[model samples]
Target: MNGTLINYFFHCKRQCYLHAHKLKTEHTSDLVKLGKYYHKEFEEKDEDKKMINGVKIDKIEGDYLIEYKKSNSDVKASEYQLLFYLWKLKQAGIIKTGKLKFKDNRDDKEVNLTLEKEKELEMIIQKIKTLINSDQIPPVINKRKCRKCAYFEFCYS
Candidate 1:
């Protein structure tokens, strides 16, 4: 229902399930801490949390929805997360493009929403809803980026 849910979907299903069930581990994660610090240090005056339909947007520039990232380690997941936001905005009759800002690398990537992408996002949202509603928690699958994930310890231990 939120960006974190979409992000966890791309990263790890187990994480997504855990997060949806209110099992949060981000507060104790160094990686999460670093990310928060990075955002705080580079946060612009105009950048503030804007909630739209329960989804908290990082920032909005004119007609562009801007999402800031600390790194590009999971660029795919990040992209999908941004797309999900765009989909949500579009559903509310606010058509806006997305811009991904990587502060550490000083890079920016533009994201455009299309009919195909919207259909894909809808399918994904349905899957996410079904997964979250299920009583069974998804199994954990190890990955290279697991070490830096906020739910790493919770999943591993």
Candidate 2:
């Protein structure tokens, strides 16, 4: 349950549940459209979806997770998201371990996650799941990162 899908809920539970369990949605933004393009570009099914699901990966070594970012400013969240994906993989028994990778053609740069920081991430996962299942919208701290979130208005309003 700790994956991109869950991370989406970390921002907005309703959105995550709607998209994951129900696949319910009609509207799509430019960012989402572009994100789909990136995912398609980096996806590699030959690697075996079942195999990659819960295996511990040292590095992206391959397309493990093609996290596309528009800038380095969002690296932290991207890493968190990727780790959550790994967690999901682990939960589903797909991957036992893996680090994050961030790529952005806009900045012509890439960042390989070196920080383990798994303990902290594990703690947050528990908290997030608790809050999400409780059916509560997390408070907005009004950070710069909130600017790009699709649910900003719904949550902050």
Q: Candidate 2 lDDT, tens digit per residue, 1-157?
A: 5455545655555555444444433234556666566555545432433345553232344535444444455455556776665555556654433333334644433333334655667677676566546644445557665556555555457
lDDT, each prediction = 0.86, 0.51
**Number of the top-ranking candidate, with lDDT as the measure:** 1
User: Given candidate 2, what's the lDDT at residue 136?
Assistant: 49
Q: What's each prediction's TM-score?
A: 0.90, 0.55
RMSD of 2: 5.6
TM-score of 1: 0.90
For model 2, the stretches where C-alpha displacement exceeds 4 angstroms are: 5-27, 44-51, 54-70, 85-116, 140-147, 152-157
> In model 1, how large is the Cα lDDT of residue 148?
84
Residues 42-88, candidate 1, lDDT per residue (tens digit)? 56565456788766788888889988899887788898999999988
Output the TM-score of candidate 2.
0.55
Clashing pairs in 1: none
